[model samples]
Target: MSNHQNPTHSIELTREATNRYVARNAAGVEVTFGRGEDLMSPVELLLAAIAGCSSIDVDTVTSRSSEPTEFKVEASGNKIAEENGGSHLEDLNLSFNLSFPDDEGGRKAAGLVDRLVKLSHDKYCTVSRTVEHGTPVAFETEISVGREEDGNKDTE
Candidate 1:
């Protein structure tokens, strides 16, 4: 017999309705995703992930110097439609707003902010690295038919 180690991180997503899904992490944190303005779409989540990853890197370094009063990140991108009935995000950008205490320590930390941000994009942020390197992603899907009360019926 052979023992195999599972992937370190994974999320489970359940489709709740049309274009709506609930994704759950190992710690039971749940996020709701939907197609319309009522919820975050997949594209929005991608942008958020990129911004969040970088923000985490910057925040981690800044916190060691001084207590940050505020940290905000805005992520945006353009979705380009492809000829094969698909779309992709292009021109991804993230705007960061950071605030620190009005003191000498804060000033010192502020001086390092830009360098930290650059370091984050260059080396620290995994999401940014994956996007930049054009990493190939593979998916495995399983279909379960004739389940009970799944909100849809198979006419077979």
Candidate 2:
């Protein structure tokens, strides 16, 4: 077998109520999401992950020269449903608007913006690359039935 190794990234979600959940990462940081009210939906989280991955790529490269005065990235897509009951996002897009101060370091950083953004989307961003390459996702079921007492926690 080859000696190549890949790091694993994972998050676990626990349901709070009927439609609400809390997602926790390995570091224990948590984010609450759900279906009711103004909470972000799963689709929104996917969009954010794409934009966030690209943002990290661009910032890592650009900040080597100078810090950005402003950095904003927006991910957008049309959620569409097929006749077969499957739904997916269409026309997905990520837009970046970054600015640097008016000076040499800033100019140098600004000069790298376009290339950095392109490189991020085409190469560096794991999230976007995984989507663009159509990576296969395998699903397995490991459900445990809780009995007797206070609705024993599930969702993980």
Candidate 3:
């Protein structure tokens, strides 16, 4: 079997309040989310993540010809609950509404929108690809009462 190396991406989520959390990445960038009218819920974040991932992929290719006047990607899906108390998203979609200038470069960019979107959906967007493929997620728990006073570990 051939083994392919894959880069790791991760974020640490810290609870701020009831049903609220702040997700921090390796770069220390953080985003807070919760279930409130003024905040975004986990389900909303999932939709945003899907759009953001595909936007990055499509933007990289489309902008090569010309900058778009309007670049928007709206992701939506219906959450369905089954009889066994399991829930999942269905009819998930990512709609791109883009507009370019009227000149040659703009025309070139506009021309690539359809193909680029397809390319992104089919291969480039990692978030959607993972969801579509039903990637297995392994969960684990740790009982770390406290961190060591000093950054040292003695494995005796």
Clashes of 3: 0
For candidate 2, the TM-score is 0.87
Model 3 misplacement above 4 A? 1-3, 144-156
Please give each candidate's TM-score.
0.84, 0.87, 0.88
- Runs in model 2 deviating more than 4 A are 1-3, 148-156
Cα RMSD to native, each candidate? 4.9, 3.6, 3.3
Clash pairs detected, candidate 1: none
In order, candidate lDDTs are: 0.88, 0.90, 0.88
Candidate 1 has a TM-score of 0.84
Candidate 3: clashing pairs of residues: none
lDDT string, candidate 3, 63-93, tens digits: 8989999998889999999999999899999
Model 1 regions lying over 4 Å from their true place? 1-7, 148-156
lDDT of 1 by residue, 24-112 (tens): 99999999997977999888898999999999898888888888898899999998999999988889888989999989879888888
